[model samples]
Target: MTAIGFVTRTTHGGFSGELNLLPICAHIDIVPNRDKSGDTSPDFRIFTQGVEVGSGRILSGESRGTDYVSLSLAAPGLGVRKLCANLGRTVGLNGDGSFFLIWNSVD
Candidate 1:
């Protein structure tokens, strides 16, 4: 797993921070999707440079009841499958901020 971003909670129940993907470091915002109409709808929207790039679904750990954000980022350069990640608490991530966007790749 790789720590790709550092984010902190915002006063409006959102998150704002920097998404550092090597040479592309941009300030990003994880804002609540207030217009969501169904349970399957994304709970949050991710924006970078004022453009929507991804979405986040609220999730909970099965055993520990830990809160998490299941994120999906899609870009023309990222290919057919959207990049998926789990934004979880920073407790043991060895990173900054209250949450970390962790990328877990299966071999």
Candidate 2:
């Protein structure tokens, strides 16, 4: 897992970060998706400025059973396939800054 972004916890319980998705990078805000009423609904919504770009769901870690955000990110700026990633504790940061937005690799 490669961390492509850094996010800090917001006062409103959301996250504010800068995402670098190679061809397209932007300052992003991760906020709760208030319309989550079903199992498949996204747990959180992602935005750049005011435009929605993606969403995420809470996922359990495979090795440790810990929780993390599974992101399904997409926009016209991005390619046809969605950019899937994970949000978790940074290795060196130790959750101090919540330095994350790990890119999940297909290989």
Candidate 3:
């Protein structure tokens, strides 16, 4: 049987900030909890290639009696100078979760 390995990362200092994540163009954020689900879906106002330039739910399941999930966004549409990406996520359910977003440029 193949064993699965888990990994967790922790960042510190000025290395963490919204600007560092989405420094240009897009306004990435978590779906506010106050807004009831099914009433409203996430809004990625910027659209490209006939696609919304965002990703769908990457995960969905229950953990520790709580629902765990995430969402993401793709790059290439933003027209950035470098080949980069923007990704966002929401954990738990009903938008009561936290967000992890990043705008990365790869050269």
How do the predictions measure up, each by TM-score?
Answer: 0.82, 0.87, 0.28
lDDT of 2 at 15: 86
Per-residue C-alpha lDDT of model 3 across residues 34-88, encoded as one tens digit per residue: 3336624542232333444443332334554543323344566535443233333
Full ranking by TM-score? 2, 1, 3
Which portions of model 3 show Cα errors greater than 4 Å?
A: 1-25, 29-51, 61-65, 77-107
CA lDDT of each prediction against the hidden true structure:
0.82, 0.84, 0.33
Candidate 1 Cα misplacement greater than 4 A, ranges: 92-97
lDDT of 2: 0.84
Error of 3 at 104 (Å): 13
Off by over 4 Å in 2: 92-97
lDDT tens digits, residue span 43-82, model 1: 9999988899999998888998978888888766556767
| Model 2 lDDT tens row, 7-107 | 88787767898998678679999998777899988889999989999998888889999988888888888878788888877767746658688888744
Please report the candidate that would top TM-score against the real structure.
2
Clashing pairs in 1: none
Decoy 1 TM-score against native: 0.82
RMSD per prediction, one decimal? 3.0, 1.9, 11.7
